[model samples]
Target chain A: MKILVSIKRVVDYQIRPRPAQDGLDVELTNVKMSINPFDENAVEGAVRLKEAGVASEVVVVAVGTAANQDVLRHALAMGADRAILIETPAVVQPLTAAKYLQAIVQREAPDLVLTGKQAIDDDAAETAQMLAGLLNWPQAMFASSIQLADGRATVVREIDGGQETLSLQLPAVISVDLRLNEPRFIKLPALMMAKKKPIETLPAADFSVSAPVLTVLQIAEPPARKPGKILNNVAELVAALRAEKVLP
Target chain B: MSVLVIAELDSHGIKAATRSAICAASQLGEDVHLLVTGNDVAGIALEATKIAGVSKVLHADALAYAHGLAENLAPLLVQLAVNYSALVAAATSFGKNVLPRAAALLDVAMVSEVIQIINATTFVRPMYAGNINATVVAPAGLRILTIRPTVFEAVAATGGAAALETLTATAESGQTTWLSRDLVQLDRPELATARVVISGGRSLGSAEGFKSTLTPLADVLGAAIGATRAAVDAGMAPNDSQVGQTGTVVAPELYMAFGVSGAAQHVGGIKDSKVIVAVNIDADAPIFQVADYGLVADLFTVIPELEAALKAE
Candidate 1:
């Protein structure tokens, strides 16, 4: 079976995000960019499928600017057989991204597609399912474990109360949760080898998908929490709590 | 102006977050319609109808909805979206997953994890891990929103005469099928949907400590146990149990912090709770700012005493 994993280039999760001066969106200048953590899980899951001899080929595909080449390279260094970059400057919404991916899936005709359950930036958590809807494919989102055999896949999803196990047919889309697998780092030697690997670049306009229907009007920073005050002793704190009806 | 509130139900019954969403829906004028889609969810619809101010309850019962997969439910929601001015769902995993897809299908923007309904078209939502609050106005006509359950109080169950209407939908079997379910059946209350939450931070030391010290206290109070991202990263708790900017956002009636030096991310998730009480050795911990009650004492000593006091009560 062939595997295709969707990756996104997002602002580094570690940095403190600040709103732009226009108060319309996050300021991205000088901010470090990396492959979204969830996408990393997806990439890692695809690599595992290859290691387990379940997948014949693993292709890592990313949709973003030319600068996202670094992120696609990272995936290639990890273990993907090849990389595809669909270059676009526009901020693609989940539906638009899903439509574009549907076109890609039609071209590639991969049996399995993997992606992160949600991107940290938008926290939309809908792309994989939306793609599944657009393609009428089965989806196992927030999948903690995946077992493939007999043209069917058994996936364990981490739900709100507990874990739910689902069986899906081949040619399905699965979104990886954090607990699915710990992503591996690329060694310097592997990084050097990745430079020699081939990356196919496709312009977003080449896809028949249209512009996003919804537009982001503005992005603003949340209110800052007030600094805490120190209490002298436990008794005083208890008294204060009782007075405030918190500890009564 | 009618509001459509999506009702969430599990095996246990109606989720508390859905109750909160119902309350939020009540605030948007009087014509509040509750939409329920699931197998054997008639009981859930019956219970939702009891909540005050609910005008109608719509049930789309089908076997395909047994798992409540977003792929299948999004289209059903789009069909219902035409009648209501705004759509509301709880910010639980199910709501977060399906609402966006529904919004996308409707070709409209979604305002997620909303804390307040500013008006018909505008709402207040937290962005950047709750670091910044964004007040947004949805495009005119219809608005799609997901409410953080903790922000609103549950509407009182006054046993209103809510009219129940059954709607049929074409079953779209996706690539997936539910095989089995393994729920971590906790005797204690749920954390995100609980009225009271007692959370421990990295200062608890280890998972053993959390099990020994925090679990007992939580069990006695019938409260949900929560942990900071530090504790989760330290492997003391699973990532799903973590409460922070990236994790679950909860606003229980009462939130108790133990040995937690409230990081901005952690505070952002729980700051909406009605009352906060902090128990930490360091008096200057950032958690005390939002905490209604602050205790400067070692949790090792204070937790046992607090548990005993609660037990005595």
Candidate 2:
């Protein structure tokens, strides 16, 4: 069995972003970029599956600009056997990304496709399911644990009030959640080896993007959150909460 | 153009979030109908008709949709999409799982986690973990939406007498099979409904620390328990206990945070909380800026002190 992991380069989880002057996007100048934290978990999951001998090979794929390859390289260092970058200059929405990924999936034909439930940037949490729909495959989304067996993948997923386990046929899509795995750091030797790995690139112009679209009208800092004064000790904090009447 | 709202019930019967989704649907300038899919749930559907702004109830009475499995229900929604201009559901796990699939089948984009309905076709939503809010426009076609209910006031559950319409069960999609579920049955107040909430972070170190330190405080205050995504990721809390962009969005009257250095993802979930009190050793933790009362002290040191103070009172 082979596994494909989708990677995305997003604004670092820690950066508090402000809307750009264009009023349609976030300010990118000096903003840090990194592999989406959940995508890192997806990579770790694929690596673990390979290590457990359930997966024959792991391919990391991403759809974005040249800078996104850095994210793919990070995945390669983590353990994916190869990388694919569908080079696109467009701001790929969830539906469009899913379409591009579907194109790649048709070519790769991996037994399982794994990706983050949502990216920190768009936070759509829509791509994997969309890809599953386009591919006509079952999706066990927000998977916390996955096990491969006779032509089936059993996924333990996180839901609102509890956890549910679902079994899907092979060649399905699974979206990784936060508790799926702790992503490992890239080692020095692995970093050197990843540089030598093969990375295939495809131009986005080859595929017509999906329609039924959305347009961002404006993006502004959510009316500034009032910064409360920092109190020195617990006594002051308690006194304040009492004064505010949340506590007696 | 009519709006169809998908409603999910809690063990206690219908929840306020569903009512809020109906309230949101009503604002879209269209006839609002709600879909309730579950086994042996027609009685609940009858009860559901009392919610304000719900003009009709579309009940899919079947065992297959009891769990709201995305496989079986997504197709059902797609088949029913012909009559409706917009399909709306509260941005819970059920909405997250089903709407995207329905939208994909329709070959349309689903505008998700929407906080405000600017008009019929436009919306305001928080992105980049609530640090920035974006106004988005859905083009001409089916408009699919998953409403973030915390931002909308729930309409009254009594007022309207809506007629119940039974929907036929579509051909079952046998692609995925449900196995079992491990549910967290907490007797305490639920995070979304609780007046007071006590949340923890990864700095709690381990599940043992979380249970020992946070549970007592929660028990004493009769507050719900919530966790930052970091704590849930670290296995310090259950997945359902998570509060963030991907987790439970909570806005209790009093939301107390311990050992949580507020990351943007976690902050996104707590914006609705009325009075935020944060206790962290790191004075510069971003949570301090959003908190109403910020204490720069170790959680271990202050939590016990505060617990003692509350107990003495």
Candidate 2 residue-wise lDDT, B233-265, digit = tens: 678897788887778778787999998888888
Give the C-alpha miss distance for residue B205 in model 1, angstroms: 2.6
Docking quality level of the chain pair in candidate 1: acceptable
* Per-model TM-score versus the true fold: 0.90, 0.94
Q: Model 1, residue A123: what's the lDDT? A: 68
Tens digit per residue, CA lDDT, model 1, A22-102? 887788989998898889999999999999999999998887789889999999999988998888885676777887888
- The digit string of per-residue lDDT tens for model 1 on B29-77 reads 6488988889878887777777777889898888888777776788898
RMSD of each: 2.9, 2.3
**Whole-model lDDT, candidate 2?**
0.87
Best by TM-score: 2
Which parts of model 2 are misplaced by more than 4 Å? A230-245, B202-209, B229-240, B297-305, B308-313
lDDT against the true structure, per candidate, is 0.80, 0.87
Worst lDDT run of 10 residues, candidate 2 chain A, spans: A205-214
